[model samples]
Target: MELNDKIEKALHAEQKDHEISAGWRLILASALGIGFGSVGFATYAIGAFIDPLGKEFGWSRAEVQGAIAFGVGLGGFAAPIIGMLIDRYGGRSIAIYGLLGVTVGYLMASTAGGNLCYFYLAYAAVAVLGAGSGPVSWTRAVAARFDRRRGLALALTLSGTGMAAIVVPPYAVLLVENFGWRVGYVGLACLPLFALPFVLLFFFPAKSGPAAAAAAPVSTDAASAPPTGLTLKQATSSYRFWLLLFSILAMYLGITGIVPNLIPALTDKGFTPSAAAAVQSVYGFSLIVARLGIGWLLDRFWGPAVAALVLTSPVMACLILIGEPNYATAIIASALIGAAAGAELDLLAFFTARYFGIRNYGRIYGFLYTGVAFGAGLGPVAFAYLSDLTGSYNASFQGALVLFALGGTSILFLGRYPNLSAETRPANH
Candidate 1:
């Protein structure tokens, strides 16, 4: 009845929640990881097939590329709405259903009737699944299950994307070369089916210990001090929110936005496709290295410190890119940029939870993911446009260098507020 009693009850609920099994957490995290990884493949794979697809369908380059952009925009449009729903309903339910949608979308895309409109339809459906089933959903799921090792947990979950980058592109290239792009897409459809059994039926149990007990109703004013959750309005008003937004924008704009174009950019600069693909492989390799390294740093240091370290990759990459367009330099630059991107994405989700409590994590993470979408989605088109205007890939890349630098500088400004309040901080043995 009293406020103190309510605080005690809330604490009790948290303690009970921690009783969840580690095995359960790992299974859910891995399943969500694979699902999110597939999203990366879906978004970037089209670029590799652009000329081929256009040739087969008799569509112009801009028209086919426009369809890819449309899918990205549609995904961004759907993110906030999906976030709101996840905040209202649990992420498990949404993730399970969205994976099914992804399967259907991929199957349709793989078998698209040589028409530009068919590609648009398949991609639009893929966009819907992406908003509901990607990092935002996975991060929310991790947030619900763990409180003490939250950073490590989040980093592990997001490492899926980096892994996908390392693994998927080469496999896609092989599939497209040997069989055709269509078969490569069919392979993607199988990813969601694999994820579904683990997440829907195996890993995601209905309720953890405390969530079940806390189901009883209590008077709102008496049960919580300010209340148990954050709303979108309250989140947008916070300073950290905007800082995170710009940080993600800069990372995406300078790094991931350019990643899918790395091979083509090298080819334009006089390297053969084989040479360019080799350079791209270095980029993919660094993503895995960065994820493992940053995951360790995130668990041991302040969020900003880890972020600053990760941000260095883009700045370094830009310097190399601007100095020379040769194969060696491009390889180094591409790897650096790729590593930074892989690490930054994981850090963004980890920091979002560290800085903001996980009470309304889905909604907050959704908004942040939107900022990421804007940067990554528009990045390639913008780079190409700038190249068209300047008549050089160097000029466009130089612009990206500036953006990466600006983003790196901003991370140094994250003030040293402790990650958790004394009451929320972990208890010593």
Candidate 2:
């Protein structure tokens, strides 16, 4: 009987290992979905489109950039509602519909015939309809799947944006150059369609099998069950929530504002357009490195400290660009900015899980993501407006310096992570 028990235990352990290995499919699917989703393709590709659309429509830089601000800002209002749906219904179906909506949105955008209002309306449709394909759903799925390596897993998932950053700039430039901006929009629309199949196949949670058993949290106790943290109201009421919101707003206002403008800024400094795009590719590579590196650091070190260090690197980037930088210097600055941009989403996802817990993750992350969307939308417009006003990007870079400092400092006060599991909660009244 003892020998039989040992053999059974050995087989069970082997089976558990196999089950854990299967979870990588979930990670890969989530990464692909995120890379091609609205946050990935739409946000990163906007920079390449900015000059073409502006020249074509005879619009100013600010006017050209405002489309994203108008779209993502207004669309962000839908995040909490989407979050509620995800928490109740799960992410897979929502992601499928959202990707399809993005495809249609891109087609609509492609049909714009130089009417500025029409362009804005098309982007607005993309934001409103495609909100489900954003980080809110993808991060929720990833956060639910991994606990021990949650930070790194979230990093890898969000690295899809990094991949988009690398591919979209050059690709967008190529399309706009070869086929015109209209065709460029048509090509961009195909990305989410590519991601849809992956999400359908792997984003779903396993049920009634060894895979399900492996996917389950290692701890099977009541404390380790799903929905293990503060409610949305409770999270909102906490001081940390407000602080995090402010940090996100400031960091994105600086980072996202600068990214879409980097190519233009480089071109202004005497680099050719293709050379500028190459620098953007370098920035994208930095994004991938930052996501993986900062993610690993978050798991081993205090998260806020890691965030503070990474977020502040962009201050140096701003300083570098404030002067007339050499091509190599410009590349370094772009890389620094990309590192901060890469770290921002990873920190937001990891912090949401660590500080707020996963009980209300969908809703909580959705509310926080509203800040991300708004900041992203507004940043480019703000940067362009500043450039338009001053006739130089230096003033905008100076403002970013301040924003990055303030944003980095705020997170340091997040203090330690709280234990908000159901078992740890105190009964009220």
Candidate 3:
């Protein structure tokens, strides 16, 4: 009887550890939700609209890109609040409602005529409504379900952005080319609806309740027990949190700046819109590869070291883009930039889990993501403004080079991940 009990206990433990096998449905749903979510869809699709909106409204590139900066940066301010909500209420209702709001926001954008305020307002609506649909909610859900495979799971989930990158650029370009740009916005708006059924079906296991059970459903033990880790106050006091925050901010500034402008820059250099979008597609492919590859590397290696190596690729990409490069050169530069962009989000999520644990993961990650949103929001406008002032993108690319170097180097000082099992004790530097 004792031997039989031991065998039963061992079997239960083995079943509980089956991360991917037990939770593949949830993972698939997360990837789909994130791919169509605000971060993936809005980020990739906005670039296609920049030139079209500018031409239609007689606006400058900076003026056109300003809407994104305004909406995303301001919307990002709500992340900590949204994070708190996810912590209390769960991500399912938040993500679903957020996606619906985004659809309405995009419809508002499609109705824009010559009023820049209306355009900005439309985007602001998207950002505000869509905040819950971003990584903070989605990653929190995925983190609760995996431990040994956490890095890979996050990589898979974040690959949605990569998938968005692949699909959105060419698709948006096609819509603008055939249909009017107004119609283009409508087409983009419809994408979030497609993910709704998936989210409803697979986002959480049926047995999970709100809060703790909803956030964590890997097993009965995990579902019933409260999560362990530092609170928001505890996490913010650490230099590591601040370091990760600013490092991500700097990286996004350079990356986000380049991506929106890439289409215009290529077209300026004599590539057709179709050709420019193809290069962007290459960048998207690199994103998928990097997300998976970097996630794998983070699992096996020190994350900061992996981050340093990945982030520095943009410097070389910047150097290439500063000059008049050929088709092949443009592809190479795009791929390098894509690699860094791909790695950054998952790295942020992975670091948050490893350093802080999952107890207050939503709020901590949300606050940190605010910096990312600002950098992303600001990068495009800054790049466009620099181009308008200097008559070239060279100045902007040069500035990105500096920011990338600074961002990559800052994380090297983050040292090592603390053992969060001991997080109840004071955090030592």
Candidate 4:
């Protein structure tokens, strides 16, 4: 038999034993690592700090939100570089050590005295440290394995992020309430430490032979041999890429801006601090559900259609929050926001594969993710500035409603994916 055929036969025989593949373990580890990285450390931690920071430093809401805007936004611009490194060197060292860098940065934040610059500088370092530790590394590893259930695998991996969201916010609140934000920083550092052991899984390759060649399902016309998809240049020039890109940006502006400010916004509306934190936990619960649910749906349904539905969800959330919300309305809105935010990164990863193909998956997704990150930065600041100007967050929610509608509408134009291969087909044509 041929060498390729021989490898395939061995893989088939190994499968007959009905054992789970090495890939699934990597998926588990990926979830843990990605969960606590930027998702928990930065995204969830910042919300808890806003009130404390405002009281301690007397910083305006705009100034506080600007910290996240600059940190996560600039770090997002580094995604393509991080993605390139992962493609070349693999993700294990970067995943573990990158988080170690984040730990150090978080430690640095606890040291800031009177100077606001120190706080901003510390967050900038955390953002840079956090770049590799996010979905670019974890999701890429999961995407490389499990073509049959790729959606489910990706969802499970990203769900670690949701798990962190569910746990981190309230924990941060408790720590801040008792020990202050400095001890809260220590608490945030501990989250990534929980995932440190899982870093070893990224050290091993998921699959090792001919059957492992394609990272995902091969497109029909390109299925005979190994399939490499469109180059970065071709992908950037396509309508599908732009459509998906702007859609993610808008959806995140609604999610990222609103999520971190949820507690403050709710408390302003007459809810107590503890009650708002409880409501925020509802958002976390919804995120866990959406991450898994959206992943399953992506595996079975049309990508753009799912994107439209999820993107529109935040509009409903914003409307509910703006329109004389009750206890139940608060719960429902928080859940919608969670579902929207949780689905954004996973959908970006899946859509990158489905529309652009998987050859330059990391690079294309990185560029797109930059937009998501930038929007995350924009969302908080936008909400804060509007709140500062109008004396309430109601204006911010109305703005989010408009942006969400535009974003949801754009994806409908993506039409069909060509699944173009980079090596065989001429991208210029």
**Which one is best on TM-score?**
3
Model 3's number of clashes is: 0
RMSD (Å) of each candidate, 1 decimal:
6.7, 4.7, 4.2, 5.2
- Sorting all predicted structures by lDDT, with the top scorer first, yields 3, 2, 4, 1
Per-candidate Cα lDDT values, in order, are 0.66, 0.83, 0.85, 0.78
Error of 3 at 410 (Å): 1.6
* Tens digit per residue, CA lDDT, model 3, 257-294: 99988999889888898899899888889998998998
Q: Compared with the true structure, what per-residue lDDT tens digits does model 4 show for residues 1-429?
A: 699999987875565233225466787788788878864546666778888888998988888888888888877987888887776566677778777867877888888876888888887877787777878888777776556466777788888878877788889899999999999998887777788887764435333123445443444423223435677898899888888888988888888888888888988999877788888888878987988898889877887788788768888898898987888899999998888877878888887877776656778888988888898888898899999999999999998899888987788888875645355432321
For model 3, name the residue pairs that clash: none
Error of 4 at 292 (Å): 1.4
The regions of model 4 sitting more than 4 angstroms off are 1-22, 201-227, 421-429
**TM-score of model 2 vs. true structure:** 0.91
- Cα error, candidate 3, residue 104 (Å): 0.8
Q: List candidate 2 stretches off by more than 4 Å.
A: 1-20, 206-224, 424-429
Ranking, TM-score, top scorer first: 3, 2, 4, 1
Q: What TM-score does model 4 achieve against the real structure? A: 0.89
Instruction: Specify the poorest-scoring 10-residue window by lDDT in model 1.
Output: 219-228
